[model samples]
Target: MKKNFYHLVTATLLTVVLAGFSSCGEGKADQQAAASQTPSLPVISLPVKTLTGYQSYPARIEGVINAEVYAKISGYITDVAVDEGQKVRKGQVLFRLETQSLNQDAAAAKANVNAAQVEVDKLKPLVEKNIISEVQLETAKAKLKQAESAYNSIAANIGYGTIKSPVDGYVGAINLRAGSLVSPSSQTPLTTVSEIDKVYAYFAMNEKEYLNFIMAADGGVRDEKIENLPQVTLILANGEEYPQQGTIETVNSQVNENTGSVNFRAVFDNPQRLLTNGNSATLRVPKTYTDVVVVPIESTLERQGSTYVYQLDADNKATATEITVKDEINNLYIVSDGISKGDRIVAKGIQNLRGTTTIQPQETPFDSIAAPIKKSFR
Candidate 1:
């Protein structure tokens, strides 16, 4: 009985020791698993940045003066003096119409004028001698004037056969060819003459944009605002910036009801003849934000139409805070409200974050967060 009791005691002690060691090992593992479950976050602080950026709008390029060339008379096109893309001057003949019928009309009218003039001379001599009534002489003189007027009218019509350019410009597409009949009432013009030495870029702005532009300009009144406007940039269709700057010329007097937009015209000097009529481009209007608050866009989150960012509090815990964005420049937002300068916020990983989420705060440079935005914004 004593031997059996000693073995039982020894076995019980060993079992208790093993159970205690196993319990300690499992407790350490539980602690380690709890530590590994916490999410890792990278963070940075928001800083006040003055961002200079542009707002782009679609633009239509055109010549300063685009004149439609038209034939004034009804006739077959006898000759074409200029081809498409040809340079022409004012009063330069561009086309010649067949004037054979008009020539005949002028000849007949001239004969009538000659016969009436002879009668007038004969009647004047007879009236001076009182050989016939004065009424007859007066009638002959009137006939002479009518015939002269008819001849002049015919001559004028003949002159209309020659179509001339109304302005100094480059010729556009010619819809009518030699031997094609053309008339003044034709809907399609003969061709277009575009003065492309200088070009006009046409763009539109809504009511809100117009107000912003008027308020942002340097002057007080509308006219002064137009005159004192800053130089604008032109982005061509090929993604190249035009070397020369452009100036705003005119704005529409009234808003277009159909489109709810107002038209704006800007002029650019084309020293290299690079800007052409009917080309598409972009107009980039620049604005400088002075001492405004800004943050990387990746740091923001949209919830139920509000923009929020993960801002760290005193405990390094991220809290979802709403922000008012004034404008979007590149991939950054100019925060008009909410986050302030020197405030800590998560630079990225907002998608993985929620309210009161703890983060491992990592210090990052302001430029490092915004370098890509500045470089690629252009």
Candidate 2:
């Protein structure tokens, strides 16, 4: 009995030791599993950055002056003086009409004038001798004046046959070539002359956008507002920016009922003749936020119409906090309220994060988080 009792005590003690070891192991495993659940996320303190945002719109480009070259008289084109795309000066002859018929008519009119002058000369001596009445000499003088007027009228028409450029510009497509019939009443013009030293970019904004733009400008009157407006930029069709800056020159007062938009005109100097009539581009108006608190857009979450960010506490616990976004720049948000500079927030990868989750905070530089944005924004 004593031997059995000692064995029983020994077995019980051994069993207790084994159970304590197993319990300790499980406690350590549980702690390790819990630690694994916490995610190591990149976090950054909010930064004050100057952000430039663009309001872009489709624009139609036109030269400073687009004039149509037309004929003032009916004739067949005998000679084309200028080629298409040729630069021409004002009063340069663009086309010459056939003047053979006009010249023949002018010769006949000159003969009639000579005949009238002969009759006037013969009657003058006869009237002085009283061989004919004064009425005969007066009639001959009237006929002479009439003949001269007819010749002058034909001369004017001959001059009109030569079509000249009214403005100094580059010639567009020539609709009429040699032997092509042209007339003053024709619907089509001989060609177009475009003065493209400067170009105009015409764009439109909706009523709401126009209201905001005018209200933000620092002026009471519309003209003053235009003068105070910031310079605009032109984005070419190939996704390149134009070298020259543009100024907002005119804004339409009435909104179009069909489109519900207000028209704006910006002028850009085109010294290189890069822009011309009928070209298309995009107009970019910049709105700059100076020294504002900005946050990475990826770190923001939209829930129920409110924007929120995962703000990190001193213990690295992430809490969902609402933020007021005044404007959005490239891959960043301009925070107006609910967050301040120097506040720590998750830099990125906040999609799967839940409320009040403890995270292993990894410090990330602000520029590092925003480098990609700056690189690709342009």
Candidate 3:
């Protein structure tokens, strides 16, 4: 009976050992399945769309002609006829100088002229009465002519005290005021009269762009290409678009050695006289792109100065790829390299993934995924 009890206990211990092994094996299998699964991420496909890209550059707005109004004679300003920002006409008197000294000099010159005329009149009668020689009368007449010329020159100098506007336009910064001493050699101008009925927008591009203009044009000659170029738009300093459109009027033939850029001038109409000289602005040149690869701007990332996008392979593994951006539209980036049409890329949620991460792609529309997310307010 004791031998039978021992056999039964040994069989129970064996059964318990086998069950423990089975339980451990099943737990390991479940852990492996969970570890192999990768989280899914939203993705989008690159599309080929006809988009117009704009290349903008820093620009300056100037009047067609900016004329400096200067003092013509040296004297204290007695009257400032126009104020700053006032409209003026060509040849309109802008300032009056105190010309009391010039007036005194002119008065002295006029008296000399009268005395010389009296002497000439006296000599002519003497010659006619045979009381003096013809040579004497002729010498007196020459003196009279010289005196008249001197008087006229002095009178003209006195008239120069009144400064006039050189052009018909609006007045800019008036530095001189009543009782201010001015001169012909003064460094500062009395004011600037800018002819702003029309304005010129000046801008520049680098040497690479200058060559591109010659190469990308669709004409046989350079002149023909310039003529066929499209009109450009002006962005005002106030972040508003200028009412009138501008044409690319003149392009510098050679690049500027100092600046390493080529200058371009555009002209716009300012009938309302809104644009002023020395105003800052930007120039936007629209370029049309066709059959080009484009991706939403949100899909791109920048790493250490290089722009990148997470590209997916056939196996759904994400690879951090670099791309060259040609230009930008409203919400899309016109890519020049590193991506093409039908290429699948991570649309959003890239911060959570790493290089070569396996992702289950949840395909989403580009617009819906690319729209700027609005933050909710408390």
Candidate 4:
């Protein structure tokens, strides 16, 4: 009985030891798994504040003056004085047409004018002395007038043979080369001329924008009171901004039925000849409000149609903030509500981030990322 009791005790002790060891191994494995998991919070840098305003919009550059040079007379091109991309002045000779027929007609008319003058001279004395009837003198005078008219007509036609530039501009490709036949009625242009010293930027706005402008103006919103009105900037094709600023030249009186938008035209001085007609560019205009809160656009996130940003709390923890973005200024969002100027908001690494996540905040180089944001907002 004693030996049986000893064996039972030994077995019981071994079972308790194995159970405790198994529990410890499981706890250690759980700890390892927890340590290997990725952190929910992503580290990011915040945007710094600067005392500047920014506005960005899609814009296009265009030539203020675009012309299609056409032949005024029907003849073979005798001479082409300008080539493609050549600069020309107003009244500069661009091309010459075969003027042999016009020249001969002018000479013939001059001869007739001379003959008629001699006849009028002889008849004038006769009429004055009453040597011939008034009808004869009148007939001589009528013939002289007819000859003069013919001479002037032929001289004007001859002048049309030399094609002169109508404006000071750069010439495009010469469609008709020397020895090519041309005419005033031809469908093809002889060349194109464009004045690129200034350009016209055109855009369209919807009824909402149009009505807002009208209401603001009618409500006694003065231009000076508006923070960033009356001034606009443009983006070129190469993504470089045009240095010169522009103003609202004119707004079309009517809205387009098909597009449901109002046409707007703004003039920009392009001294470098960078802007051309039919080239695409962006036109950015600023719409400002009083005492509005704004946040960096990079801080905002969209989920299921809702826009939000990660705002830091007093504890340095992230709190998701829902914002009503009134407008996007440069690279920032103009928040009508939900955030203030001094709030610490995450501006980078937002794509892989979520609400309530812990973050290691890092200060981004103000010069690098801020440049694009400043440009976008301004």
Best by lDDT: 2
- Across 186-259, the per-residue lDDT of candidate 2 in tens digits comes to 99999999999999999999999999998899888888999999999988999998999999999999999999
- Model 4 earns a TM-score of 0.68
Off by over 4 Å in 2: 1-27, 112-146, 373-378
Candidate achieving higher lDDT, 1 or 3: 1
Candidates sorted on TM-score, descending: 1, 2, 3, 4
| Candidates' C-alpha lDDT | 0.88, 0.91, 0.85, 0.74
Listed per candidate, the RMSD to the true structure in angstroms reads 4.4, 3.6, 6.0, 6.9
lDDT of 4 by residue, 262-342 (tens): 877788887777666667877776554556565656667898887898877766567788888776656666676777666
Give all TM-scores, in the order shown. 0.87, 0.85, 0.77, 0.68
Quality of model 4 by C-alpha lDDT: 0.74
- For model 3, residues 152-180, the per-residue Cα lDDT tens digits are 98888788988899889999999979989
Residue range with the least summed lDDT across 10 consecutive positions in model 1: 369-378
Per-residue C-alpha lDDT of model 1 across residues 60-87, encoded as one tens digit per residue: 9999999998888899999999999898
| lDDT ranking of the models | 2, 1, 3, 4
As for TM-score, the candidate ahead, 1 or 3, is: 1
Winner on TM-score between 3 and 4 is: 3
Alpha-carbon runs more than 4 Å astray in model 4: 1-60, 212-230, 276-278, 287-304, 308-322, 329-333, 338-374
